[model samples]
Target chain A: MSNHELPRTEETRVKRLPEKQVFDRAALNALLDDAIVGHVAIVRDGKPLVLPVGIGRDGDTLLIHGSTGSGLFREIADGRPLTIAVTLLEGLVYARSAFESSMHYRSAVIQGSATLVEGEDKLTALGILTNHMMPGRWEEVRDTTKKELAATMVLRVPLDVVSVKISDKPVDEFEDDGDDRAIWAGILPLRTVAGAPIPSAMTPEGTPVSPSVIAQTIKLA
Target chain B: MSNHELPRTEETRVKRLPEKQVFDRAALNALLDDAIVGHVAIVRDGKPLVLPVGIGRDGDTLLIHGSTGSGLFREIADGRPLTIAVTLLEGLVYARSAFESSMHYRSAVIQGSATLVEGEDKLTALGILTNHMMPGRWEEVRDTTKKELAATMVLRVPLDVVSVKISDKPVDEFEDDGDDRAIWAGILPLRTVAGAPIPSAMTPEGTPVSPSVIAQTIKLA
Candidate 1:
């Protein structure tokens, strides 16, 4: 289901190509749910630092976890302003002109400070994050101990002040431009394919790939 | 050709898991060359702002182009310090425990200020960027005019201060942890596949798909 449209602030407005801006919260959520990783940005000293992070969507909030001793975790614990962006490149748009050529993609950018999750809520958030990365496997794995929870930092950033940009249209040629009819112009679709599972050598022989992993691959494909 | 190794600075040092750090310049270049999109971050109004950008590599530097009207372009034109990260998710690591589950990915982060290219360099940079995205399509398309170059902003960020992290190994279990022979632990490899090209409806009938597009699809697959 669809949630209410995301409330846009001055920071979330699409200043370029306003036509590509998407407002439906459901659309925003769909992008988040489909994506497995996001690029998180935070300013350290004066330079901007961007890192690719494993991400999970918990309803209206986004969950991210890391080692508490890591600098990123320490920065998140500070509750400073940060930006998390999830981008999925769908295809390569081949236009008649180099200037018009582009990619078909859906991107969501969330701007806010993340709150450190604690106690039982932290455990639940971690599980949600794990499940998001590898669906259905969470229940099969062993439970997280108190020490593990203590060493990990889980932060949740609400889905507020967000902007979504989607570019899916085919190449739009300029009427004034002259181009040869013999030249082919089109879209080359790009998809993430899940290859065969390679069981670790340490595992017992004859262990088959689980259905959940297969299902996840199918969904991504 | 392999360039000299990337000299790490206080900013680019991998503080968390030092084992995953990569210093080879060729390795860094390969990641940038293989990636089609990257997440770029720049500080605006004392807040971190990250966006997805189409990226290309020019020898030792990275090239990114956008509309001059875009705020991100303007910020890059201002010669401000920013970060660009290219991440390729290779696989999903499944471990016996939730805490140990992780992703196999290769990510490169470059921190520097972009210099706006002009005159002959501008056109060259644009061609390089376009060719990187769509290999053989540049020569087939109409030539870009002086007006088009003026309206677009092309920035070059040097790969001087860079950090690369790669996680490719399979799950490494803790020695003290008990094993469950029935549990599956392994790696699910992930790769981007290029599907059949869909020619634009406007394209003339009977036109064959170009060799460049076919080559690109094969490379990605």
Candidate 2:
């Protein structure tokens, strides 16, 4: 699991469009770190259920948390088989033909059963998630109370079985496809940017924006 | 299915955080339109498999496509039960405590079996998808040829069983909670913006940016 290259297993193999598959462990980690949200899928009564979840990466494991009362979270905490799909849409590629038009994206699919984090490890996992989401805010904010910790369920999924696919190149074209060059063909790059912070009603009138917010905005930009 | 409100089936009910559930059909459609990608979950060999797919909404149905040779696409075309989750991250909410810090997001979970679109309807579905993804480009690009159509598999799932959850409000605070008001608490708004277009090598020199690309950038901003 600590290797530089991701394991090539039958389930993780990219059978379709094999050229897009990425085996580098670094690439997988980058994708997980860049994307703040992911979709988790689990089976319930022989039917597939998927939902969006906030995610964080802690070394070779992915960290996600939910309320202890959530049914889906409980299923995952019980070690139900699950899959998490994280995708970052980079841009839209325009080609001369509609069939050739596509999007530039980096996506990773991870499959594994989750293990619930408890005791001291749970506190560390919570800190990792908090700082991962709001970089420097953990030290400024109050610590989690014992009640809050009991109500929260943190789960970790090992990143052993994973598949990564990246489509960041330009539009595809055949040499003799007879497509007109005059038609515009290019990429419209997309990015998620942070705007000015809006203070809540509870905040004091002269209070300055948190440093974490400023840092996050600049990082996204 | 054409009603103004979404049906509240047992499966579509929001068991957790019921306060965030939205039952309006228009909200669901709007969320689907605003998001260009979704994660589709399906059962493969009794295990959950999820992947990101380009999405489009045509009337009361959601359209998604993949290569005809894809095993997941084939399974979806065969009417396997699936769920598609589409989420838009609006901003990051900062609170006095880490437990209250969260993201402002709008998400919809749609569950149903897909039906394959064939013949003339498939062509229409393709156009719907293309334009939905890259607005106004379908009219400018060349039509899909027979060979290209044969290699594409488009599936449509009814917008019937759906669950929409939105968390856009400011931070939650309880009176006399002993949290300091001087600490900043607010929302760092987030938006997906588009940058200048980059022409592909095949594009002719001095070619103007496509109208669709400009429009999409403006729309995202």
Candidate 3:
């Protein structure tokens, strides 16, 4: 593998479809960048617990923030083993046979312990997260206050132990599989589209839409 | 709480935002019906592992299936503790301050040990899954073969231990919070839209699009 490829470790290896395993670090980064929400898993009270969280990738580390008063965030900040899974479903595949039918998706599962970001670095991480979710949002808004920073808990998860899987194969039909060739089979493409921005009721009349919102709407469209 | 409300147990209670907790069983069912994918988490070798799976809710049970050859599915079949999280991101909330910025979402977290489905009930569950993913698909497609049934592993997770959180609040702006009202603040709505179906190359030239595909496209639209 090239130096740019992710290491094939025991936990990071794809067991079912090895061919679908993506080793390129660039592919992993791209998937992380495209997806906005991630399901974060942690062992709580000797049982599995998973919750959805806003996610952003900063360099090789994944950033997720929660309230400082949150019990779950406290547990994650305590260095418990955690796993984050981000999946973007691209389309629904309709094969001739039900067994061959599946989804076209890009998913990444990251395994690591989170390190809490504090002091000045916390502000920078927050900015990265803001811009990641709403591009150009940081400059459009005011600076975060000290109290706001203290109330937020930003945790950084290294992208070291990660497994990326992508299923984007076109519809394949068996030549002699006895399925009806007349049965229409293909893909129904699905995508997340952004609608027009709706200004808040408190906003003064005729206040123009923010640049970040306009840019994001165009990008998502 | 009413008789139709879900039990608010220690594990199933919303920890961070108590007010956002949804105990209504119908709300839980509605969220499950609207979402297509769920991130399932299980503890393996003292660490957490999370993966994405297509999900369908049948009455009070959540159904998920995987290839029998998958090791992870085998682990889940053995009755290991599992947590499934399904989140629907509706919009991005642009609050007056960075601290208040959040996503409007309906998220459900179900924690339980999965029960393996076998025998004739497995076929019924498969039909439910097929129809859930593609409405009216079970009738249009050919029946699954015995070998195909044997190759698939279906698991049913009860909705007993569950927590549902909904963040559908309108953009909240503090009148005296000192952030610029001139900054466009509101929600940028987001949704999954299904595009027109593309027939496979193997499909007969004159084959018509399946009713399920057309219905699903309109429903998603």
Candidate 4:
């Protein structure tokens, strides 16, 4: 193998098509935190229900918040099982043949039923959620209210049911194909940038952007 | 109602939800196009499968792509029905209580099957895909090749079967809950910013960031 073996975890089991299985915790955590939203798939009323929603993560657990009133949210809070899917697209893998083209991606899927979290656990979960989105914003924000806590539903899915997969290189050509062209074949990495911050419209004129936001600028190493 | 009175096309019949049925082409398209990835939900062998993958928009239709060699991709390209879920998080809706706190969101689930688009249609589809991610990119970059075109597969799903649900206000309270303890209970808008472009390491020094990318600066207005 040209690349060193990726760190493996007992929590991570590789299937035969294992290019899609990841056993590294650090890699998985980065992928979850880097992603802004998640697609939650759950079986409701017998058919598959897949919906896109916001998600925040901390350590080995991921927090997904749905409208407290949503039927899907109610189902999970009532002890139904749900599967959380998260992905981060790194690049478009272009190949010599259309059939070979694939995406350079990192993804994880966690399967578990979500029950409602409350009391101190609920507040701590919110902090992790906030930090997952924009690192330092939580301390600047005030504490939530008891009523506010009661109105929102937070589902925590452990990292145990997680599977992370990655495909990072260019296409591997067939030995018999007689095709070589002027096209460039390499990774064109995708990244998210923080745009001009929109200060609360009520902020006094000339107020500098908050450090919590100023520190949020993320760039590749 | 002002923008979408009649459905856009024959396939795009609006399914009446208990409360979430409205039509705004601009809003709908923006939600789909601005997103870099989306949830692709399909069923196989009696089990539901939902995956987050790269998705692009073509006018009203949405396009999803993967390896022509993947069993799942082959199934989708072979005319099996599919579900594409696209979402946009507009604001963090803070309420007086935790249960009432939620996000102001826009999402749609397009139910349809894949039709392999080729030649002129495929080129148009690529343009839409490029512009969907980087607004001015297609015009700035080099042209696509016969080899590149042949290797990639684009599946178009009509915009007909769509659902757009949005909640854009503060949470409901007892009406007389003391305002004295209420924190800010309005929408705090979130935006995608365009940061300074990082040139590819292989790209020779002094090659300025592409104008197309410069013009596509992240602006939320």
DockQ of candidates 1 onward, in order?
A: 0.84, 0.84, 0.79, 0.19
- Runs of candidate 4 with Cα error greater than 4 angstroms are A1-22, A34-36, A44-47, A77-81, A88-106, A115-153, A165-221, B1-3, B6-21, B118-120, B136-147, B167-187, B218-221
Candidate 1 stretches greater than 4 Å from native: none
Q: Model 2: clashing residue pairs?
A: none
> Number of clashes in every candidate structure?
0, 0, 0, 18
Query: Which residue pairs clash within candidate 3?
Result: none
- Relative to the unseen true structure, what is the C-alpha lDDT of residue A106 in candidate 1, on a scale of 0 to 100? 94
How would you order the candidates by lDDT, starting with the best? 2, 3, 1, 4
Candidate 3: which docking quality band? medium
Candidate 3 lDDT tens digits, B60-93: 8899999999998999999999999999998998
Query: Which candidate would rank higher by lDDT, 3 or 4?
Result: 3
**iRMSD (1 decimal) for each model:** 1.1, 1.1, 1.2, 6.0
Q: Could you give candidate 4's per-residue lDDT for residues A47-87 as a string of tens digits? A: 55677767887656778875566776777677666667787
The weakest ten consecutive residues by lDDT in model 3 chain A span A172-181
Model 3 residue A126 CA deviation in Å? 0.3
Estimate, for each residue in A1-221, the C-alpha lDDT of model 3 and write its tens digit. 22578879997989988888989999998998888899999998788889898998888889999999998899999999999999999998888777777888999999999999988899999988988888888778877888889999999999999999999888866886465777889999999999878888888989999998987787777
Off by over 4 Å in 3: A1-3, B1-3
Best by TM-score: 2
